[model samples]
Target: MIEPASYSATEVLRDGRTIEIRALRPQDQQALISALDRSSPQSIFRRFLGARHHFTEQEISYFVNVDFVHHVALVAVADENGKPVVIGGGRYIVIPRTAKAELAFAVVDQYQRQGIGAALMRHLVILAHNAGLEELVADVLASNTAMLKLFENTGLSMSTTRESEIVHVALGLSLPA
Candidate 1:
């Protein structure tokens, strides 16, 4: 049985619109898959960095099964007639060897630049810090200017490079004391 997560509600304003951000729950899988499937091929490629389309069942199951101890995932959503629609999501994987983790996120095309991505990133940063992670890293395509800007706006120290037309980025997190 998939259980719903209890997340404190929060909102962000972008382009004169409001979006709600919160933690991911198992119940969100269907909505997430639907949004990802509907995403444009270019957007999907930028997010996943490959021409290989479609998320495998095993990947979906793993994303939906994360716990606070090992992983943290959050989603941004909008409610229409009481039905939740996923607009964006963020996740971090904690590396046991060193208190660091890799982060990833995506906002639906319609929701891009609407503060959904920024909110999700902020949420994940806090989650990672609280979970004892000292740094968060992301591997983004060099052409992904929007994502690059989002990371820059977070005020974290970052390094980037262009390798074969792909930009790789890394950000160090400063956990609040």
Candidate 2:
């Protein structure tokens, strides 16, 4: 497995502002909290699939301390008044003994529709493909049309299953021959 900590890239948003995409670090716990504070409750609900205001100690640890091999994570950092801030993040957790992983992403409310999520998805796809993963899956709320459209725009062969109010999206990582 490659060192996920070594992963970093720069992305240009729709407004022509540059943002850095890098691996999530243990020290980023506070930044994550700040980002969450900047996000709207509706945005949080879509990403988490429910309403949540606080993360437990265990949950924070699990989110920050990634193994890089099975649980890979990346964060989007943008300049905020000359200081870099965590505005968004994406991750994939490989299902053990399988070539499939579940994907998740979150971008602060103010930064939505600025292409941050797409940038994170592009980087994560590269990492997952290099790691020999065959597919990435996400469980998005049916009401989250933006996220559903983002997955659709990935250009990957996708299949979705609707269960109640949730849409399970599976994106094939391998290119067609």
Candidate 3:
């Protein structure tokens, strides 16, 4: 069953809007799928490094299916026009035998700048820290300046390596005592 108490937050946006950030539930598969379906091709490419019309059964299963230990996933939702919708999502899978995790995030095209992605990242980072993770890494498209700027705003160790069209970002989360 989905445990909201373990990982959930309702925060106010900069513009007085409200959003709920919580652990993704199994029932959220279709909502997420639809969110992806509504994402622009460029946004999809920035998130996945390629274009995908939709998530396959296996892929969607992997998304909403999380152990909350090694694999943590969360979604940002808000009421739009009296109906709740998934605006953004973030997740991190711990690297085998390491204090690091691979992270990813995707926001709906319409909700790009309403702090959804930033909020998701904050929540995901807290989850990762609680789960004993030390770092988060992702390969972002070089052309995706918005995502890169978001990563920079996190104030983490923010190091990157560029290879062709992709930029690998490694943000160290474990701070020294």
Candidate 4:
């Protein structure tokens, strides 16, 4: 029963750096496209864990135009000369017939390990909780140790399994008292 309009932008400070966490704005479509376009081949590979280096227009539209009622998209940004640059992003999609959500996140190459991804994930977790979700799940490649560590250190209960060369992780969020 969360109202998307009530969500507000907030800044998180980690390791002496400040990053903005907020819901995606309509004006950010071009910035997101540019960020996706500028992503390195390896970054794309790590995020999607495949040779698919490009995103179709339909894919971009779907990611940006999530149904606000049942899904939420949050982005981490750094402003350069008054224009916001997308450094990281995460989204939560409610699963039908379940109180769990599927979470996905990616940080730009230059911003990795600087707390951008964690900040984005933390914000998205709060959003999911506000929306009454009970858990968050992610599918990550086995080789992506950074993502694994992020989830592990988040203090959530998680289980992992190998699927071919990829790893699937499921995290159950602790309900807020």
Candidate 5:
């Protein structure tokens, strides 16, 4: 009976820095934008799987606003000097009328390889399972080895299919984590 919308936890990065992982709030819109700004073009391309410039108004709203049931999103926040900065985020959106959800994640370029992405994946999987989702899927670029490895290391029953330059991964959630 965990509420995904109000979910929160503290995670330590590989380098031993502590971060707060919590539900993405509407007020986090600006922080998301700031994170995006801090990311390099290569990191953005890896996350979005394509060249992207900016998000439209509707896209920004969709990214920040979640229904908590159908769409669940979480963000990793860390203290930067005196301000809280959004370092990374992950989300799962249920497929209509299906027991599966689509997963996505993005970590700030500087935070890459610090186990932030893994932390986000772990939290998202828990929320998905609590929400009654049977599986989670992700479409990653063929060149994104880190993401593919993250999925593989989850210890869930997983399968992958490749199409063109994309690798689609599916992870069954019923297995014990």
Candidate 6:
């Protein structure tokens, strides 16, 4: 099991830019809020399924504080003009009585398509495996091709079902060989 401590790693993007990935912490509240606020309306809608342009204090607080056992959150930070900025984030909340969890990811508009979301997802997958989770699930909009492709590239055979406007993807955590 991963220790209940902040983990860090460096990932190289498709364009060869590097980013720092670390466990999300309470101190990241402002950075997290800033990234979400600066995201495009369409990006916000794609992530939250609505035009949630503003984040409440309670919501920000809840997202930053993770237990790392049943709840795990990671952030991808990039230095912009010498200051670290939150560009992307990924997290999963465990389902009760099962080795499964619901996963989510969001990357700022300017950072999209740079593999930030995929890197965050990669870290989340490792955290899930170390935590002994068996499956990771996500409910993404059918039109969110970027996110859909990121999930698909996990290399695990995913079972997908479409209902209404939501596409549910289930990936078994056999921990991609």
Which candidate, 2 or 4, has the higher lDDT? 2
Compared with the true structure, all predictions reach lDDT values of 0.77, 0.95, 0.86, 0.77, 0.94, 0.88
Model 3 whole-model lDDT (C-alpha atoms)? 0.86
RMSD of each: 3.5, 1.0, 2.3, 2.1, 1.1, 1.4
By how many angstroms RMSD does model 2 differ from the true structure? 1.0
Q: What TM-score does candidate 4 get on C-alpha atoms?
A: 0.89
Candidate 5 residue pairs in clash (backbone atoms < 3 Å): none
For candidate 6, the 10 contiguous residues with the lowest summed lDDT are 1-10
* TM-scores of the candidates in the order shown: 0.88, 0.98, 0.93, 0.89, 0.98, 0.95
In candidate 2, which residue ranges exceed 4 Å CA deviation? none
| Evaluation by TM-score, superior candidate among 4 and 5 | 5
Error of 1 at 61 (Å): 0.6
Which lDDT tens digits does candidate 5 get at residues 82-166? 7899999999989999999999999999999999999999999889988889999999998999999999999999999999999
**Total backbone clashes of candidate 1, pairs 3 or more residues apart or in separate chains:** 1
| Candidate 2 clashes between residue pairs 3 or more apart in a chain or in different chains | none
Off by over 4 Å in 4: 12-15
Give the better candidate number (4 or 5) by lDDT: 5
- Span of 10 residues, lowest total lDDT, candidate 5: 168-177
Best by lDDT: 2
Evaluate model 1: give its TM-score.
0.88
Q: What is the lDDT of residue 114 in candidate 2?
A: 98
Off by over 4 Å in 5: none
lDDT of 4 by residue, 1-177 (tens): 545634556575565656677778767788887777767777788877777766788987888887766778887888767866887788888889998888888777877778877777777777777777778888888888898899998776788888898888888777535
**What local lDDT does model 2 show for residue 107?**
99
Tens digit of per-residue lDDT, candidate 1, span 100-165: 888888777877777888888877776666666778877888788888899999988788877897
Which scores better on TM-score, 1 or 6? 6
